[model samples]
Target chain A: MKGKPFFSSVVQKLVIGITGLLLCGFVAAHLAGNLLLYSTSDRYAAFNKYATTLHDMTLLPAIEIGLLVLFVVHIGLTLRMQFQSQKARPEGYAVQKSKQGRGALAARNVMHLSGIVVLAFVLLHLADLRFGLRFNEAGLAPAQTVLQVLRDPISAMFYTVGSLLLGYHLFHGFQSSFQSLGFGGERLTRIVKIVGILFSVAIAVGFASLPIWVTLLRK
Target chain B: MSESINVTLKVWRQNGPGEAGRFETYPLENVSTHASFLEMLDILNEKLINTGKMPVAFDSDCREGICGSCGLMIDGQAHGPDRETATCQLHMRRFSDGDTITIEPWRARSFPILKDLVVDRSAFDRIIEAGGYNSINAGNAPDANAILIPKIDAEAAMDAAACIGCGACVAACKNASALLFVSAKVMHFARLPQGKPERETRVARMVAKMDEEGFGSCTNTTECEAACPKGISFSNIVSLRRESMRAQCSGRSTR
Candidate 1:
């Protein structure tokens, strides 16, 4: 009733849901920009230009700070919800039956599990490409840095696996975010779910294709 | 008619609230296939009374399943195995001979165990008391046909109203979320013209009460729907989310 930041579980879920959708949008945009690395016309010139444009933008720092806040709030609320749910049932049932119509087991429980994996991958990825910390030369083109990283089997494997995990996490997180925001109606829910699946597939495949294409196909 | 079968019931036994509980097995033989689940329990109680042992304490009333008083987790399924059936409506014939059935009370932080197989469901009552009623002055009853509600709205309202407050949804949810229960009441009231007057207050108050009662948040797992004896849809939770947000954003509160 009072105007407190932390009110109830429903309000917490609403915050988490809205922020989650915002993060989803950020991921989609990020993937689109990353895909420019595959442009054939220029020898990584276009990709470097795109990276420079993003870096030069005055709003970049503010956007980065906002993203950091979103991640912290989303993960914090999610962990709290998980802990409360766990405590609600302290004792276990002798024989438990699996629920119906809830989708795959991985999709249901992937939030916490895949979330950690994606977090670790993000840090490593930023270090390698965003900060150019792994490269001896600091001012290399974005494409060259990406190529250099993917050329290593360990980095490529991690990127590939991380992309797949991100896909799984988004696959459920997308539609669930909509539902949490109270978007309901038989037809609308179905459409949201379909769009969620397609978007998840696109982001995952798009990001994964980068490393695979750089390592195997690009001359 | 199906043949009668023998069953071994591993029922949970607890002395009282905050007391340690354990499974006590009772072998019931030649239970009538036509007898309802409560009737079978009655037979077991009769045996216990004759043998001078304390009878298993369970809650039940209106053996036809309308009162919402009788419920038990049979073999880990809320309200027994048959879909859309309450425990009182379930027959002993559903069980196979020599089957070991594990019966337990509704385990939830909100609904504390009062004794063996009985929990204090006052939390649900408090949630209802929070805002489950419409404010109407006492007067001559209005004509039933005066407010002609559309068939679709009436049906939807009835669907949500079918919830008997049995607490099966809480019992079955992995998170022990009462979203299904709260949502049903929210939808039932929100859909009717009579209930529109206090719709905002009803949703906000009920949700707050549900949280205050120590229930967990709904992660949309939907185990509650699968276990619901009344077949209440999980979509109501979606409606509840929308309604609650609308109220909060509008800065409306009855607190």
Candidate 2:
């Protein structure tokens, strides 16, 4: 088939939407696992066990590699698309107004910026617990190291803000993924939008709750 | 009561495509509130011609707004400040006296400036030529009621057919994408039984042409729909995305 390139504009957008939705799914699963921090019964024994179990899994490396591919492809396509869109209009208007409401415009425009913040926070998170960079790990449990990282005011504040920005990113992205993939019906779109808002709130509050908890009661 | 308004127009003036363009201010007096936006331009053009100056060049026909020939970026808003109204349909009553109205052409690499406030929208025509019709000869015209289409499909098809191809969607889109226009054409036929034959190849070829023309990708901001004079919904763009993918998968001819 002598067709268009595999990565045409439409196909680029299709891949981006797929990868973004997959990342959102990963974030939800990660948030669920992180809730083990609230296990105060065994002094975080369950949380530590969960961490160790995840580390010892045979498929952990493959899963991590898959996740890295998703992030790289998703973020790479977005940067290229954004740059091309800017070039599409070399000379912009002297004055321009959004027929779309100002608030909605701002939300869609800030996707890349918010995505950057979420990426940085995720890296910071990995440094603290995954790589043991924040504290000495000679005899420390993952939960204990997590507490040390969250105890630092700067780290806690960054996590809180980053989590909120993630919610902001997903608010448009969750519904946007379906549209890009051409998944729509009369009622399906409205339902996806409503659910997108709820999911965004759940993720933001769920992740931010950790730092707040460690800062306050875990002292 | 009808009234007259004195207004200043900051119109974009470009001598040629390669030449640098600038805004020239013209203070017009005694413009009738009942006059359409293009009529105000006519008054200004007459004054310029009377003074032996080159009048502004623009596109307009069927001043009643059906031909999709008139478009302008007035005061930063596509088709002026009215909702679902084309530039030709915008009346001066919406403006107050002493208002400074800015006029510019559609700014996009694909839609080049041909003259003052007039762009070369032939790129849209090229896309239409790519594969926007059913050219097959299946005999004479069939009876109107011979083809039985469901009511919902007819309404949906009509909704997609509302696109007038005025290029306002392109002008107002932040990405300067023409997906709204392209999708409208795709869905216009795809909703009815007559469009199913060329559905796969049509989307593929048109999308390739759109990319070749350097239009940006859709980000689903719904800005295009808001700018559309006919109020064409953004959902057509979504359906086009599906149609393109479907073509790549099971089409008889890829090109």
Candidate 3:
């Protein structure tokens, strides 16, 4: 990325691509960790304990730093891309309409929906995970802390719904990112589609299940 | 079914940009509903030519809808009442024999009216020239199957290239946004392996030219697709945004 203008629209997209891949990797790891909640033995308990060990002392700071960096880059890149796109057409087309074809929804609303997910989910996620678990001054035990939020049917439902929305974002976005990366070709297209579906489903199910397992199964 | 109907046509008649323009009305009887709109226009023009008057000037080449040249605003709608047919392909069955049809040229600051209904759309050509292609003018044609592109990507590129460079998109857009048009071109080239070398440059320059051409921002109203003869998808536009972002990130030089 040397000769290109530093703040060009393509650079913004590259930042988005890099940060998006990081986020996707994080989602994969988080999904794997979330599956631990289903374990019936003390292993499940131990897993939580170990997970919280660093999360309680070290991981939180590192994660907050990493997340902050990723979010800033991701969002900054998005804003720049959008600005350039707006600047691309000054006076605008005299005859403008949605392109007539198969992809009306994903084409028109992906950006708008992605924007909504970031704003609403970030606040909700911090409250649910960051503030509730790590930063709570009340010092509720991790299990009790988790249960406190999940025990409420409404809160649990909200978490589930939010996770589903996250899945929708990832569903379209995962495939879209691969397309942007120039990854798809005749040999890998089917694989990309399959991986995209699996990734979205795994993330949605893992996240959605946490609330359900805590609220419904415990009751 | 042999009923003779009378209708008045308010057609835009402008000899040149310097000349005063007005709508001229013509009365016609026994217009078959089965004829295409351009065919109907042909009937009207033929009548005028027989009367020793100059036939109304409009653009219609490759009437099958691929060339993207035939566009008109019929009764406030681009390409008449059809959902996605070109004016040349639009049938008169969309209107009653007695219906008054108002035909107007595509109106945009970028697309100047050359004469009558024929507007000079070379602005699109200039935009394409500005950076709508890959620098890989690799002189020798490479083996067709050498690139190893996924069929899906190839299909996507083909979809973007389906754009016929018709100005219907400009006519249908309220803001006169050229995002769809520019995006289609950008995405078409950006999606292919052959296009990767100059991907960043192509997007940057094309977008820059699009802005210079005075096209408006896209408000997401899908009038362009409805009026499009080829029914190019809006997905190509999204692909454009994604590619633009990716290219900007990669720091590739624009050639």
Candidate 4:
């Protein structure tokens, strides 16, 4: 309407915040499914069966298409925001010092943390889950079979490291998402922050337990 | 104890905008660590006046730091070594004996040098004038609690309002960004019930004024937060963005 009608900073924040939260939700669901690898022998098989049902029986193709759309939008919005923020500071300072304020250092570097999480997800997560899901359709023997796969030194190490990275990303993403959605105020914000911390710890511990249980305690 | 501290002051002296500016050196004797940085300046100014020399020019008022009238770059910093404290509120104890201090006015296109350590920060006022206030004129009285607001929103508004309008944000910023300052004003009123009537107009006008002032955009370097006396949150900037988009798309498209 008035002034600049196209893309603005608010749009950039909204897109980043919403997309980040959506991706967080996806990660939580994925982690829940992975935890089933610790259950009984039939449980792991049933998990794959559910995955097959969702993929072939239902409209999963449509869901993947939707996910693709969201991922594209999120990446596009993040690039624009990065460019604007870069343009804002053309002359870099000699000695740059910043305050922690009421926010944490991890929260301030969401862009950097997200980059790490995405990288680890691609290299390790793909090998363990996505790759297995695609090629090894013979089906897992049981939860113990899934555990045996993860018990490898490399797999366990990557799982432990990757889940930590995910937790770091969620540490900031949880509180930031609420602020972005305009749901944060005094009272709700306090509750949201407590829940955010709890979520971060839960995701970290829940995901890390997979590697630990499989590698050390499973035998 | 009154310690004999040898402090070297390199203060900028400018007769006017068109005149030449130079860093004048002044050596002080027996300066106490208990005195405020401004009080030290006062002592130097008093000596200059007594010796028939023109006192070094600077701006200061309400030394308590709430007025935002006192500000200067000390040792290449917006408000000296202290974090989140105004220049007037900075104590001499932060510095050791024989420390050399460099003081200069805020350097930004919007804040032109008027003289010495005093610059014309009226550009900030103009930005506020552009649309930082409410225009609801009423003839009758309304109940204080007529419109209910959540305590969270009120606290957030107060936090945003804590901005003292000091141009330290511009000085700390490499690009001379006004986002922190502009966002502080925008978020302050937007969070309140009384200011809701002019939310769209305020954002539109304030942002335009900021651009016109030749201030750069927010690159997220976050130096402003480091320099701010109130320690204003960056989330306020994000909040400003959200409100700006909503205002632009709302019914006030024409205005």
Query: TM-scores, in order shown?
Result: 0.91, 0.95, 0.63, 0.72
Error of 2 at B110 (Å): 0.2
Give interface RMSD for all predictions: 1.6, 1.1, 6.5, 4.4
Give the number of the best model, judged by lDDT: 2
Model 1 C-alpha RMSD to native = 2.6
Better of 1 and 3 by TM-score: 1
**Cα lDDT tens digits for candidate 1, A1-219:** 454335779988888898889999899899988888878577878778998899899999999999999999999999999898888877767766644644436575557888888888888888877776776576777677778888878778889889988998888898889889999999999999899999999988999998788778864
Off by over 4 Å in 2: A1-4, A103-105, B253-255
**Considering summed lDDT, which 10 consecutive residues are worst modelled in model 3 chain A?**
A88-97
- Tens digits of per-residue lDDT, candidate 3, B111-151, equal 77777788888989999998886566756777878668899
Single out the weakest 10-residue window by summed lDDT for candidate 4 chain A. A91-100
TM-score of 4: 0.72
List lDDT for all candidates, in order.
0.87, 0.89, 0.70, 0.75
Q: Among the candidates, what TM-score does chain A have in each?
A: 0.91, 0.93, 0.78, 0.80
Candidate 1's displacement at residue B110, Å, is 0.5
- Determine which window of 10 residues in candidate 3 chain B has minimal summed lDDT: B214-223
| Candidate 3 residue runs with Cα over 4 Å from true position | A1-11, A56-60, A80-110, A133-139, B1-33, B39-67, B71-86, B92-122, B131-163, B167-204, B211-255
Per-residue accuracy of model 3 over A1-219 as CA lDDT, tens digit each: 344344433234445766877888887886776666676476358556756774768557788799889877877766655565445433332222243444435523465565566457667667776766433648665555666677767667777887777776777666656654555344575687688788888888888888888876777
Instruction: Categorize the docking of model 4.
Output: incorrect
Ranking by lDDT: 2, 1, 4, 3
